[model samples]
Target: MTIITRFAPSPNGSLHLGHALSAIVAHDRAKADGGRFLLRIEDIDGGRSRPELAAEFRADLAWLGLEWEEVRAQSTRIAHYDAAAEELKAQGLLYPCDCTRAQILAADPVIGPEGPIYPGTCREKHIDPHNCDGPVAWRLDVAQANRKTGPLIWEDELAGPQTARPEMLGDVVLLRKDPDTPASYHLAATLDDAADGINMVTRGMDLFSATHVHRLLQALLGLPVPRWHHHSLLLDEQGRKLAKRRHSPSLADRRLAGEDGRALAAALRAGQLPTGISCSK
Candidate 1:
């Protein structure tokens, strides 16, 4: 079967070296295998998503000499996500959660792979499975969902095959409090990959644990599964993970400062860090 990969980036910030590495890796993998590469803007956060930054992302990719067969944005796929959420609710796998982050933290939550896990405060609350009232997030009841699907398994191109333990991440929010767009990254990404026919999902290793939850969502939602390749993240001189919030130098900034984007892309592919960048240890 032909391999299909994507470079999905949130347009909330500029592309840093880490983002460049992911994009190049996915693009090269698809080209080397004579497959397809796609560009997806994950602008699900209605408040933070900047539509203007999308053009900058395309420009940066082009500067690096990377090409994709198709481009898509999550903002346009709300209906698919809504339908998937409804399907999960119909299965009694999802329920409305009124707990806020502060409340979860205040409950002395256990720290999971994805920060403080929700204590399931709203699990017992009367949640309208069909139509929830008030501003509330929709969380996937991992325990209940697992009971229906039984044991599940997914493969990582690098980490090898493994059994899925979605409960490790606890009950994750599949749909947020947004009235118009309720899908979270977990729900949207799982459905989007299936919708786009992506056979190989390439992303940062920081999200490796998220695959556990994604696997469960795929099984519960009846979507096609795809192999994952979680690559290393880029780091700064201080050996800290590159984050847009920390003001890591963006590809556009470097390019504007006379850096050769193609040369930088080559260095990244060869496992070499550019001037001041390092690999996460």
Candidate 2:
């Protein structure tokens, strides 16, 4: 099978060095294997997603001397996600949740790989959608879902084999209560990868734990499994991950300053990061 990889980024902010490294890694890996590289705009967060940034992302990739076989925008695929949610709901793999962040925290939730794991406060409530005054989130019933699938495993290029442990995430939201953002990241990403025929999932190691839930979702949905390459994350001098919210320097800024994007891309390939930026080993 032809190796297929993608660099999926949310268009909520400018593309920073960390984002560039991820895109470059995925792009180079595909080219090295004579495979297809794709670009995906993860703009599902309707409230936070900036549609204009999608175009900027395209320009950034092109400026870096990278090419993609195709591009997919999550905004155009809401119906597909809705269909998947309906299927899971029908199989009793999902339940409605109305708990807010504060409420979950008040319950003394334990911290898992992704942060505070949902305590399943509303899991057994069987919330009636019609009776509810507002939208309700739909969370996966991971324990029950696991019972159906039994033991499962997935491979990471760096970490080798991993046992599927969806419970660590503890009833993750598949569909958010927010009307503007219907599907959660876990649900949309899994479906999108399968839909796009992505066989090699390339992303930062920060999401390595989330792969457990993705593996479970694939099993439940009967989607093809793909090998993952969880590459090192780019960090600042303080060892914190570079983030847009932190005002990390952006690729667009450098490009506008007359910096050569191709040269920067080449340097990144050689593990030569910009000042104060280092890759997490």
For each candidate in turn, the TM-score is: 0.95, 0.98
lDDT of 1 by residue, 1-281 (tens): 89999988888899899899999989998899999999988988777878899999999999999998655689889888888888988998888887778889999999999898888898889766466546888899888999999999999998899799988899999888876556888988998899899999999999999999999988887789999998888878888889899988899898889888999899889898877777765
Clashes of each: 0, 0
Candidate 1 lDDT score at position 81: 86
Clashing pairs in 1: none
The superposed Cα distance between candidate 1 and the true structure at residue 135, in angstroms, equals 0.3
Q: Best-fitting candidate, measured by lDDT?
A: 2
Residue-by-residue lDDT tens digits, candidate 2, 104-125: 9999999998999998898789
Candidate 2 Cα lDDT to native? 0.92
lDDT of each: 0.88, 0.92
Give the distance in Å from residue 209's predicted Cα in candidate 2 to where it truly belongs: 0.8
Cα error of candidate 1 at position 113, Å: 0.5
Candidate 2: give the clashing pairs. none
